[model samples]
Target: MNVLLVKDDCGRSRKTCHMPTHTAIIALTKGGKQLAQRLKTLVPGSEIIPNKGKIHQTFAQAWQDHDSLICIMATGIVVRSIAPLLQDKTVDPALVVCDEQGRFAVSLLSGHLGGGNALAQKVADVLGGQAVITTASDVLGHTALDLWCRDMGLAVTDKQGLTRVMAKLVNTGSVTLYSEYPLPPLPQDIIPSRTLDAADLLVTSRIRQKENIVLLHPKALVAGIGCNRNTPAKEISEALDHACRTHQLARESVRNLASIDLKSDEPGLLAFAHAQNLPLDFYSPDQLNQVEGVAASAAVLRATGAKAVAEPAAILSSGGGPLLVQKMKFPNVTVAIAEILQPFPTLF
Candidate 1:
């Protein structure tokens, strides 16, 4: 992941962020320039982002370009400027702060899933300072919800449920970590359960609705799509997005896109997969037609020489799991969702 280091002054403050792994730095003048040059020695791939007048603007620009941020300036200044860009724990980049003297490394924001807390610890390790982390779960020695989901590669279907369930974990209440999949050792605060009625945290791919239950969907869903020639990638994307949302499926859980090999070079389908950053797997018409129980479409069979493309491709790509979404047609695109098979419903 790309890291952005923003510094106002030199000294240990700038050096604290110049970890050997950092990729770039943004420095305001007044001693920041020389620090950037010196930082180049320690971090090979790191580039110095030159800044003079408005440090806030440079920092803002880095917010979009980088995966995580480390500010070697006052925490208040960093917070005020980044307040506008703070979205949520899932989408926001990790942010850390260090004083000019580098006495303390603080995780200012996105400490859990975004990895701010770990970055702070790394900074402290480098500068021989204290890593200041104040998140309740971290302080209380409980498993952080965001960290747990991230570690398990699960995507929360409903973020609202996650907030409430996290509150429970932080408040000394137990959370049932239900997984049919064998998980590693879990924290004391999380216990395994089998039923939704007894669960506060559920890890599964099946659609479920419950209040105050954190639902983590594993990245085990596979999608298959078929689109008309020259169809805009945007429309295909929107159609798949709608299908996932409407079915209460986690988009992050989608492993890849599948389609008939006949369209191996189809630009529209390839564009959609590229936009989603998922691999596109294509099978020949014979392969797609062999998958049993795919929804039949006379038109698709006539046009593509396959009885069904979307549903069968999805099931086959997912290694023949049950289909979560049957073929859904919208505009010039057809989409389907299937869960990647696992031994159990929930995994540890």
Candidate 2:
């Protein structure tokens, strides 16, 4: 994780610059020079970035570029400088603030979602100071949903639902948690319920349009693709979307896209996979044909020496699972989907 250190005053902070080498320090000149020297002594390999322009602009850029920001400046100054750029918790970087003396590290924003609270503790440890974390979930010992989702690699489907449920949970302790996936040891606030009909928060890989239900999609599905030569990338993408839509599958759960080795060099297929940010796995015709239970097509068998393209590819990619979608032939592409089978028990 990249960290950016911004200090407005340099002279006094020079000795305190003994931060870790991975940290990038933005030193405001004049008063910042001495602080930079001090920091350099403390942190041997950490590089210092000269404050080139407006402080707010630097803060904004650092927020985008780094995973965390350690502001060795006044909390008020850091707050105002970063206020304009403050956005959603899901994407914002962890923000930690320390006094000019580097005493009392404070987690000012994104305590859980961006790991600000954790960073505050680390910074406080480095400075021989105290970490002040004010997030209610952390202070009260309740579950931080955003942090949990991030750690589990689950994507939030209904962020508004999450906020609404969180308000109810924090204010009235009225939220039920249910999951179709494996359960982790949860806080008392997130009580398990048996049914989605009674849940405020739902965790699954399926698409749901119900109001006030925050869906946490686990990465579980693999998609297989078979396209004719010269097929446009858009067609391949659209076909996959259609397949997912038909099955009410959350497209976010797609782990990767699999195709035959013959299509490995197919520009359109490769481009589509890259654009979708889905890893593409290409299997040999022998490997594809080895899989059973796929509907055979004469044209596909003759062309690629495989019984089917999409079905076998999907099954193989998922490491042998029941096909969630059989080979679906579109005008330019054939698509299939399969859920990766796991030993997740349904109940206690």
TM-score winner = 2
The lDDT per prediction is 0.74, 0.74
**What is the per-residue lDDT of model 1 for residues 181-300, given as tens digits with 9 covering 90 to 100?**
556677778888877678887777656776666677777888888888888888888998899989987777787788877776677766666556667667768878888877899999
Judged by lDDT against the true structure, how good is candidate 2?
0.74
Model 2 C-alpha lDDT per residue in residues 26-123, reported as the tens digit of each score = 55545545554565456534445556888888887777666677676777788789888878887777777766565687998788887789878976
Candidate 2 TM-score over all chains jointly = 0.81
**TM-scores for candidates 1 onward, in order:** 0.78, 0.81
| Candidate 2: segments with Cα more than 4 A from true spot | 1-24, 29-47, 172-174, 182-188, 343-348
Candidate 1 residue pairs that clash: 179-346, 180-346, 181-346, 181-347, 183-348, 261-283
Q: lDDT of candidate 1?
A: 0.74
